[model samples]
Target: MAKEIKKVVLAYSGGLDTSIIIPWLKENYNNCEVIAVSGDVGQGTELDGLEEKAIKTGASKLYIEDLKQEYIENYIWPCLKADAKYEDYLLGTSHARPCIAKRLVEIAKAEGADAICHGCTGKGNDQVRFELAIKAFAPDMKIIAPWREWSIKSRDEEIDYAEAHNIPLKINRETNYSKDKNIWHLSHEGLDLENPANEPQYNKPGFLELGVSPEQAPDEPTYVTIHFEKGIPTAVDGEELGAVELVTKLNKLGGANGIGLLDIVENRLVGMKSRGVYETPAGTILYKAHNVLETITLDKETFHYMQSQIAPKMADLTYNGQWFTPLREAIGAFVDKVNENVTGDVKLKLYKGNVINAGVTSPYTLYDEEIATFDEDEVYDQKDSAGFINLFGLPIKVQAKLKAKNSAE
Candidate 1:
């Protein structure tokens, strides 16, 4: 038996799967009201007419919230500061889900809805991301995942349903690519991308949206300078800008240079491998700049440990939707403390998908030229190396002596 649900708040995108969901919830839930909620995370032009479209599709009303700034400052920055990434993906969709889910929960409670619903399929990692974040905010709020319970088995079937219901869909069978876009990045999956053997036809007109492929990139390189204040990107070149503006500026430059495009077959948290092509122009540039800055500013141990030991953990947590957990917070605290001194500027040359470091500068830089230079210096490190090498090599020397004695005996 279906539970008593008078009203439901739905996570809606203007996509094919969600475009039909507003009407499906009403039809399946005995004419229950659906309050469709969409988030604007810098997916420019995607939010257009969402309110009109939602209401036209039997939604009681629609809420489109601007979550770009909050998402960057809270989600993207933390991951960047920790230098976190999963496989070949930059965690763009991974970071946006929690922010959207939190807003969905807020709207659900504010509207006094009986249950919360999402358009995420049961097989995808987004289901875990959405449901976990919803659970964190409203433990008692009943959740509904339409794809898990619905009879529609594929995107083609969803298009058919939309047609049957007289609901319009932006994508048809031929151009149906599962896509997620935000300020951080744009991702494309499904269609030919499902087959790892098939090369992504990036030059096929509409295949690559963010920028041109590296093959089509200009011959000349583009130089960029990024400034970091305590691990947060504050400016591009010498011009100070907000997070959104800075990222937008970098995106234009990086995209033109054919930067931040990757094709990966990653292991999903649902225990399945999936193919996705991601274009993260600004994120790629920022991560590269931050990594270069850290080399000069951060200490040997902290830099090594953060990138080696802690970054993968942070990536897993973010990718797995464990952002609200205590462990994530503790890890974030440690990252923040370590980044307290990571203030620097990094210049890079972006050419044909390569980010080559040109220079790095920081007031707190640990790179002392006097000690590190090959020429004669007054730091007096040349004579002391013999004693240090002897002590450092003592264990190997003792082991060699023991092996020699054993061979002689």
Candidate 2:
């Protein structure tokens, strides 16, 4: 019921599902040239052999774009500024998908590709993410999802297909857990994680490489100072660095101190529950530091309102893969306005996975030392509270007086 696609650009990651997808698309789509595009959004050195892997597995060509800078400056920073955390998560994996999908659309248009394909499963949020971004950018582009169309039901079937087609896969029987990794965080799912009652052995050291185990962390405390200007992190300790460098430094320092580790069962947009372990040391540090700075910089009412209303919506939008939509952009505009004076410095002590706030200060701070002093102060009058309390409790006093008079009568 769809138009015939000549050449397809597939968002390939060289995983089990994507490996089989390359050969599968070629076989089914009349042997179309499947151009593979992998977005290098801080996957580290894992991009080394990705191009070769794609080509060998029947891709006509491969495009690996370095999106680390864009990812940090555009996507991650905006979410961080808004304090966008989905169900208390920093939205590590979800935030990266839109940027990657956008690039895929760009590559498709440049190559005159008839269709865009992905390996996302039918039930997952990524299928919605990749497709929505594609639709947002290039509405007319034909979308192909192999998992929705294919007869393959299990990972074993995918392995068999890859073997038959000579497609190299990175998965094995031992490392059965499926993971999505980026600079922000790493997500673990599948296997035992599907069952909520199963005790996750995240404590096993070397089980994952993102950060150290809490038990394995050093007993001695590590101190770090974060400097922020308008809610954007500008420096670490006293050294000024760019966005990439600062996050990398914090990741190393925080990871060493075991400062980030999370286990949560979250509700997916697709109406299913998923349990995942995320390690985001740098993100954890950044969130805490930003929150501390806001305490000094933001006014009580506006800050509390934004915290209660705007923050959760931003988190929900990011988690639901609505990054490229107008609502998110509008929210970002509001967030930028609110963060205009959020400049400050926060000193923290990290010990055995605990990040304790030592102190926070800012030039734009609303904390008036003169008014808050218990000792003699000139700013606030002590007698003003009597009149203020009388007016404040007028309704209560009137109600009680009326009730007493009626009872006496």
Candidate 3:
């Protein structure tokens, strides 16, 4: 016996899985009123015709909330400042899920819905990310994951169901690749990408979305100067812009230069490894520029500690759907402290999948040329290092002396 669910709030994207979910919910849940929620985290033109489609597909109402500012400022900034990348893979889809799910929970509460649903498959990381956020915001809300409960086992079966229900789908078996897009990045999984042995058809038409491949890049390099204020990008090429505008500007420049294309086999929270291709134009540019700026602004200890300690953990937390946790918040506080003086401009040359540092300048730079010079400089006494080395190696000297003494005796 199924529990009676009068109304359900769905985290809807007009994608294939979500498009079919509306009708399936109605069939299984005794024709419950489905309120579709789509968080517009910079999906741009993808939001067009979503309301009409939702309505035609049997949704009661569709709420398209603009969450781009929150997504960039609240989620992407902290990760960027902390330099968090999971196994050299930029966490594009990982963090976006929480931002979307948070909005879903809010809409679910406001609409007085009985349960919340999502289109995440059973094997993916998104299910964990979405549900954890729901628990954090609305703990008692019942989560109805259709993939886990429904009989639809594969994409083939899903397409069959869609056809039987007279649902018009834009995708077929040949062109279908599971994808997620936001302003920050676009991720592609499924299809040929599922096999690690298969190289991505980067040159194929419609294969790459955000940027081109290294081979397709131009001969002339493109140089970009990014200005950061306390670790947040504020300008590009001397023009001060808002957060959204800054990222958008960088995306075009970086994409044109064939930047921010990544393919990696990453460990998921579900205890399995998945291969995916990620195109994160602006994010890659911002991360590289921020790293260059930090090299001058931050001290040796703080820089090393952040890169070694905070970065990997922050990556794990974000990858594991622990964004709203106390530890992540505390880590954010520490990151904020370290980045207080990380204000500068970083110039980079983008040429065929490379981000070469052209220049780095900072108001609070610790890189003093005089002190670091190898030539005779009054700023640093080279002879003074002898005493420091003798003291630093005293334990080794003592152990050798004791060994020699014991052998002689």
State every prediction's TM-score relative to the real structure: 0.98, 0.96, 0.97
lDDT of 1 by residue, 134-189 (tens): 99999999998899889999888898899999987777789999999888899999
Off by over 4 Å in 1: 1-3
**In order, how many clashes per candidate?**
0, 0, 0
Task: State how far residue 125 of model 2 sits from its true place (Å).
Answer: 1.0
Tens digit per residue, CA lDDT, model 3, 363-398: 899999989887888878778999999999999999
Q: Per-residue lDDT of 1-409 in model 2, one digit per residue for the tens?
A: 2337889999887778888888898788888889999998888766779888888878999998988889888999898888888887889888899999999999999999999999899888999888899999999999999898989998878888888887766677667788888888888888887788887676765555777877778989999999999999999989999988998899999888887888889999999888988889999999999999998888898789778988899988888989888999999999999999999899999888899999998999999888899999888899999999999999999999999999999
RMSD of each: 1.1, 1.7, 1.3
Clashing pairs in 1: none
Q: What is the lDDT of candidate 1?
A: 0.91
Best to worst by TM-score, what's the order?
1, 3, 2
Those runs of model 2 whose alpha carbons end farther than 4 Å from true positions after fitting are 1-3, 398-409
lDDT of each candidate versus the true structure: 0.91, 0.88, 0.92
